[model samples]
Target: MKDIFTCDLRTNSKLPLGGKTIVFGGDFRQILPVIPNGSRQEIVNASLCSSYIWSNCKVLTLTKNMRLSVLASNIQETTTFAKWILDIEGKVGSLNDRETTIDIPDDILIVDSTDPIGLLIEFVYPSIVENAKNPIYFQERAILAPKNEVVQEINERLLKLFPGAQQEYLSSDSLSQADFVHDNIDETLYSPDILNGLRPSGMPIHKLVLKVGVPVMLLRNIDQKSGLCNGTRLRVIALGKRVRKAEIISGSNIGNRTFIPRMSLTPSDKRIPFIFQRRQFPLAVCFAMTINKSQGQSLSKVGLFFRQPVFTHGQLYVALSRVKSKDGLKILIFDKDGKLTNKTSNVVFKEVFGNL
Candidate 1:
């Protein structure tokens, strides 16, 4: 970016960002750059504060909780919730021996429930079957989990309750022809079943089941100008053989109806030995979403499902801050011993904020 700016603006290379004013915004307390199978030091080193630009950058902090201010009705309650969120973000709670676990307050914790997942779904989406057709109900609420597998479980459970005929869409997967020809790879090695089983991040899975009126999130940025970007949630209106018609439920373009077509997508993960392509609709069931993917999204009601402890920085905080108020948020922490506990792991990479 600096090289292109310096050449285009006719500025010296030594100048910071080509002597142009560039404002970078985001919280270092949130999740840092994701490095696959990376160590703690490696993940922190990949952050923006560790870059050369940090030496020339002036850090600016925005202390106001704008989301709370806009959505919260009670000023005092909003202020209290904002403070609590900051404490969670800074990891100020009583920690366990590993300094990773923190005790969740009783108000937000879902306790005395034998079926925690069922309770969580009920809390987030009350009367889901009746409200399944209402786009506003889905737009205002969601269940968040730390891992994709857990999210899928919650989504599938919620889908079973949703009232509609289920339609399953299978992706057409194959190894990239160019990669196969260039590398002289054996075609017999990767069968269709093997290709179908691979679930790459940010891409729809091989078998996608959907029902009319169920909410689905976009995996790719199909049309940004139309507000059909990645992470944008839409309600399926009409299912077709070649295309799907959905109504945008979230984002600035709410209620805007659009048609989504099946597009060929390739996995960007370099760890894969050969290039793989999958042709399918870039959508996933959004009854639940991973905490990492829930960033930048605000909801009136949010259910935090903890099948496993958070493994990354700011994940717990990110999930907690999504709701409008404490009353709107519900958390379920599952223990292996079949005992109810409010304690959960809160992973925070403090080194990323050292320079800032």
Candidate 2:
């Protein structure tokens, strides 16, 4: 993938794998490689099939989806759903002259006039208090939001609804050591307010509000062998000044308790135009998570709160496909402009799939 990103297959003077045959496997429809601040053309150019070596590589595709095959009892519906998803991914839907936005099918849209968050909560996790401690219950359901701000809002609302002890942890936020080397840099430049505003995805916020028995996601891969990895969900059990204890709620290591300590985290956003690091706990409330983070994880039920439409390719597709059954998925579309609507945009760069 790196070779494709750099087009280095044809440009690298020193290359060990230049003579070896390699195999690449993944669904291009799932998620594309993330290139920080890279343009659409740059992203397409960074794909494996876009490299010069792709000319010599044989393209083989597997047509049958094992997931759909296993759910063969509802073959017709699933096949139609899968085709609709591919059309969105391929931008084959009826579009305006620019082909930017399309009218979402009414059958798939959930129209609501009141609070979307409240509606989504009741729809996905009815009787939440009864199953707050049951790890299996949380592992099967989650609300997917498109941005960190919206995820935080939904998590905060759900946290209030969760029945348990409330706990708050404030991060010791500061500029990185590298930023300290410059004597001209003032401490006031990176104040607590500014640091709080810099809550990028994959990094914890300045102040973390938690409650006992509430589910949270690990932000770092503390120990892969222990099933404590990024995106691993856990339920809070105890809290301390230095470490917080949580029971694993997902994966093969369910019910295992582990301690999370303060760790230094750096944001991967080159768009920030500044370099800084944060020292905070590697855990975030998991009542809701950004759609980007929910990729590759299957859920029994999904609540998609679209405060903002998806901005990139594969995001909408990934969010909608997280659930195993169509009946398990529920979407709430709400924007800042007081109106009940279900229409959204799908960004599909057709050229990216040209090699396929």
lDDT of 1 by residue, 293-343 (tens): 889998999999888888887788799888877789988997777567898
Q: For residue 276, what is the lDDT in candidate 2?
A: 75
TM of each candidate vs. truth: 0.93, 0.86
In terms of lDDT, the poorest run of 10 residues in model 1 is: 91-100
Report each candidate's C-alpha RMSD, comma-separated, in the order given. Answer: 2.3, 4.0
Candidate number of the best lDDT = 1
